[model samples]
Target: MGQLSKIEWTEATWNPAVGCTKMSPACQNCYAEAMSHRLKAMGVNGYADGFKLTLLPERLADPMQRKRSTIYFVNPMNDLFHERIPASHIRQVFDVMKKAPQHAFQVLTKRADKGEGFVASYDASHHPYLAL
Candidate 1:
């Protein structure tokens, strides 16, 4: 009864936040959007607003307790670099990932501009995969 997920390169998914708007044809049938609405109707606390960008700070620490070295899809249900998400919150997420080195986090975003901005501000020591 926690976060819902599908298989990917990662061992599992972690949706610290949920909901998103479509920005491209690739998003025509966003799985996040569909999942959000379903979870909303099911009365999931965070999805009460259904697809509106909301931060879930409570879920931030979930990765730290895991014993396995996992590849975590940073957020399958939402985009971490959405414009609506503040930089401070993004930093918090990154901080968690940095602390939990046992888990490899993968984040995908359709908002390339916002993604670029996030990359520009990220600490290179913690995130060497960043490219401008």
Candidate 2:
């Protein structure tokens, strides 16, 4: 099942991977930082390392498994393009998104350069489901 989200702009949350690092002055009050720590303290499955950058390959299929259409805020607990997250893993997440066309993915990231670079190199044109 997809995780229902409280975030106003999106219908559900999908953290195929999670965790992020402080990148700038804008990160001074990141809600993810506090949430990760709190989730870790509560023994949340994917937050064993707390706010430290980590990957959860198992969650990659969350969206595909859900039959209903949804708007997914990808990696809401952290930036999807964090320096520590491998590009290959990001691709895996994208591959999942490409397969699940019923959903719209909102992939917001503080690391826009990396995000743009990934977009440039990723071969999405051939995929009928991927919009861009």
Candidate 3:
């Protein structure tokens, strides 16, 4: 499972959704794209389609189940603001984050404008930043 991550900066990985499509030249060397293939080769759950941009609603409650405070790297395998990821789903992700206030989520996305607009609908003062 991706519940715990080996990434040095974060305590754990919360991939409520996984998989993505290459959008630009920078995607050729994407760590996530590489990892997606690796995880797929290893038969990891949630990566059956490799990098096809699939969403996993079942994983949304992952943080709520944990009692310990954590720093989560949200969607390390995909962008939270990807064109295909709907605002309702993002709302669900935020709702889970809201419920699990003990944890801090780090959400990184190339679409900062969309991310900002999405976060505007909610009280996002305590949540993740779209840009670094």
TM-score of 2: 0.93
Instruction: Report lDDT (Cα) of residue 84, candidate 2.
Output: 84
- As a TM-score, model 3 comes out at 0.89
- Per-residue lDDT of candidate 3, residues 8-79 (tens digit): 999999998887777778778889889899999999999899887999999988889998899999999999
lDDT of 2 by residue, 51-81 (tens): 8888888899999999898999899998988
- Scored by CA lDDT, what does every candidate get? 0.79, 0.87, 0.85
- Count residue pairs with overlapping backbones in model 2: 0
Q: In angstroms, how far off is 48's CA in candidate 1?
A: 1.1
**Alpha carbon lDDT at 12, candidate 2:** 95
In order of listing, the candidates' clash counts read 0, 0, 0
Ranking by lDDT: 2, 3, 1
Q: What lDDT would candidate 2 get against the real structure?
A: 0.87
> What's the TM-score of each model vs. the native?
0.87, 0.93, 0.89
Preferred candidate (TM-score higher): 1 or 2: 2
User: What is the C-alpha lDDT profile of model 1 across 1-132, one tens digit per residue?
Assistant: 123345755577777788777778999888889989999999988899999888888988988888678878887889888878888988888888888877778788888788887777788696655453
